[model samples]
Target: MIRGEVYEYTIGNLRARIVVVSANPYNPQRATFAVILGADVPTPKSPSLVPLAAGDPTRGTIDMTRLRPLTRENLGARIGRLTRTTLVAVDDALRTYLGL
Candidate 1:
């Protein structure tokens, strides 16, 4: 899978969006990513999140709430990809959030 592609992983009852960002050569099963939750996405216990809607087909505001270092073992199927514009927006938001 390439970066910017959104994947739907089996997360019990929640259908969360997983973007395949940077992959780690050290661990093939894992990658650095952000979780995109729909507009109605539940309030996360953690306040860290970036708002995104530019590429989502549903056209709902998505929350890139957390940056996760996750394993591909749980990823189920390919869903879609975020646009170049959306990816740029996310990167900007992330940089701002991290005070970079």
Candidate 2:
């Protein structure tokens, strides 16, 4: 599992942090909603997020860099779809990171 945090800075406010979790170590495509909390801090409600990293590559597949880009206005849905699609493409690029 891959675990991390995300921080967002507002114009006049301190930066906020959210916990990131993934199912696979090598793939961000397999991540799911684990938790959201203060930066560099863990909370009681924090879910055990896991990494969704891919395991291996497949034969006769195109590179991930050649694939089309995905965009979404909804944060939740966009993340869900991105994770699913990323894991599916792990065979082509080994793993994909959205850097969300």
Candidate 3:
């Protein structure tokens, strides 16, 4: 999957949604694993949470602090894609969180 695509991922007994944060070239088509961040709506406020697009039906905040590597096998179906603006916001949040 390409970057900014949302998918369902199961971690242990918890099934959660995640956003594909890895660049397209480093995703499943080329790499064994990809980077991702957990996604949720109406969560507690934090600097690590980047607000999503207001127009999206599935609008939610992406938890930048929950970043992790996901295996290709664990990557689930495509749930949604982030808007261009939202993706840019996420990129900025990532940079800030990582101190880049």
lDDT of each: 0.64, 0.28, 0.68
lDDT of 3 by residue, 17-53 (tens): 7787878878765522223433433477666677777
| TM-score attained by model 1 | 0.68
Top candidate on TM-score is 3
Q: Considering every candidate listed, which one attains the maximal lDDT?
A: 3
- Considering only N, C-alpha and C atoms within 3 Å, which residue pairs clash in candidate 1? none
Superior by TM-score: candidate 1 or candidate 2: 1
Using lDDT, rank the candidates from best to worst.
Answer: 3, 1, 2
Tens digit per residue, CA lDDT, model 1, 5-33: 67776566776777765543633655767
lDDT of 3: 0.68
Q: What is the lDDT of residue 73 in candidate 3?
A: 65
Per-residue lDDT value at 20 in model 3: 78
In terms of lDDT, the poorest run of 10 residues in model 3 is: 31-40
